[model samples]
Target: MASDLVELDRRAVLTTMATAELVTLDDLSRPTPCAGWTVGDLLAHMAAQHRGFAASARGDGADLAHWHVRPPCPHTPAEYAESADDVLTAFAVPDVLERTFALPEFGPEVTVRGEQAVGFHLVDYVVHGWDLARALGVDYALDPDAADPVLRIAEMVPDGPDRDAPNSPFARALPVDDGSAPLDRILRLLGRSPTWPDRPDR
Candidate 1:
């Protein structure tokens, strides 16, 4: 089951990365459903996140104090695509799931078992990938099997200090219509406005 989940997550990352690669700078500058971040900022942020995750997969410590956003290189979109590939490679490495990793945000110096860490990466990338696609006017879909576990994990994230910190990426709780699907409800609960800008015509 863990392997299957990882495979689904890999597929989601690849699909989202391809969609992101197709976006033009003009499209990236447009307003996104995420309150303050433009599409470009979101792209940059995701690319950095991929790189950071890749580093972590290699047993690099979680002190990203030296991490800095590299300026978009010769072919910026391609670079982002490559970063996604790097993340996939790191995650797919043999025995990677047998290692311990440091996740600072979850704690100052705590260690998580391999499967739990993989699940965390899967949830983060898959959801953030959806955010990028929704913001960039691209079609994005998560494999149902993959999304199911991620939604469960998301639900367990209590709406407390971790989620309500001043600089938290998620917003405070919002009312989710009872009829909303799990994915939409989860997104809304985490501060994404379901009615922002305009719904995608697709």
Candidate 2:
């Protein structure tokens, strides 16, 4: 089961990479769904996160330095691809699911089971993949197996003042109709508007 979950994470990551490949240097300044972050900023953060998760897989995640996001620089897309490959390789280690991941960005002593951590990683890519696609004015879709589990995980994310705090990674959850599609519900639960620019065609 853990391996299956990791496979899903792999698919999500690969999908995100595919979307990112469409980005060009000219697109770097474009704003994304992540509020103030432009495409370049988002890619830099994504690559840093990949490296951090890879370090976590290797029992070195306790170092906060591993999770730091740096300024956007030249050849960011290439760097992002390399970071994605690094993380995927690290995650393929034997017994990886049995390891503990230290996610200091959550808190100083924050730790999660490898399986749970991978789930976190999976959801991050799913949403960020959507973010990238939207910024590029393109469409994005997750693997069929991902919708249910990612939605389940999104539902489990607590909503409240914590989300309103400064530098909060997520925004406050928005309302969505009960009959909304899985991806719509998932986006709202994670504080993203499906019609991000208020377009009727979204």
Candidate 3:
């Protein structure tokens, strides 16, 4: 089951990377419903995140300060996409999951089981992929196998200090009715107000 989830996440990451690559630079500068970040900022964030994940997979501890963006270049979109693909490939390497990961923000260099670390990467990218799509007027969907685990993880991210920190990008928790579907609830739980603001009023 764990192996299957990892594969599903790997596939989702690849698909999301493709979608991100197709996004135009014009779209990157537009306002995303995500509030603070423009399209470019979001892409930059994802690129840095991919590099950070790659570093961890290579046994480099997640030193937040080590997170640096690739130097600005003319073909920024292509560069970001390539970086994302590189990280995905790194994560897919044999026995990567079995290795220890040092996430400094999470605390002193704790060894993360390979499977769990991949799961974390899966959830992060899938959600961010949706963010990219939402901001760019593109469609984004996650593999059910991948989305299921991410939804579970999203549920576990309490609407507390982690979600409400001073510089947190996530919004305050909104009241969701019991019957809301997992995906919708998950989006709302993570700060996206599920109602599509782009729709015109009849």
Candidate 4:
């Protein structure tokens, strides 16, 4: 499961990078599914997350400085790509899955096993990759095998008031039909709409 999670995470991050590369300067101003954040803002957040996860993989995640989001700039895509590389490299270390990951963003004393942390990262990129693709009016896909595990993790995320907290990355969960597609179900569980900018009231 650990190895599978790593491969899926790698694919998700790489897919996100490919989608980001398709963005021209003018596309940066485009609105994203993430409320109030533009494409550029999404890229900045993604890059910061990459750096933070890399630091956590290296047992250096407790420092809040590593997770600070960079301001959007013309070279945001390239910066995001670099951060992606850093994270992939960090996760490549021997016995990394056996180490503890300090995720200070969760709380000052929060820590989790490496495999769990990787699973968390995997779910994040899977969703955020879709966010970027939707923002760019493109498509994003993860490995077919990823749907089950990702969905399980998404289900485990609390659907309560914490979602509305300041700077929370997710919003309140939305209801989905029992027959909804796997990806759509996962998205709704994480407070995202698969249809995105095309809501009926919009």
| Candidate closest to the true structure, highest TM-score | 4
Give the lDDT of residue 170 in candidate 2. 72
Q: How far is candidate 3 from the true structure (C-alpha RMSD, Å)?
A: 3.2
Per-residue CA lDDT of model 3 for 20-93, tens digit only, reads: 77777677677665566677776776777677777888878567654555555533577677777778787777
Model 4 per-residue lDDT tens digits across residues 81-115: 99999999998887778889989988999999988
Q: Order the candidates by TM-score, highest first — what do you get?
A: 4, 2, 3, 1
lDDT of 1 by residue, 1-202 (tens): 6777668768878877777877886776776655676777667766776776677778884777413356754235666787788888988887777777767656668778667777877776666777777777676666777757877776765686676563355766567775877777667666676555575311
What do the candidate models score in CA lDDT, each in turn? 0.70, 0.87, 0.69, 0.86
Backbone clashes under 3 angstroms, per model: 0, 0, 1, 0
Backbone clashes (count) for model 3: 1
Worst 10 residues of 4 by lDDT: 69-78
RMSD of 1: 3.4
Candidate closest to the true structure, highest lDDT: 2
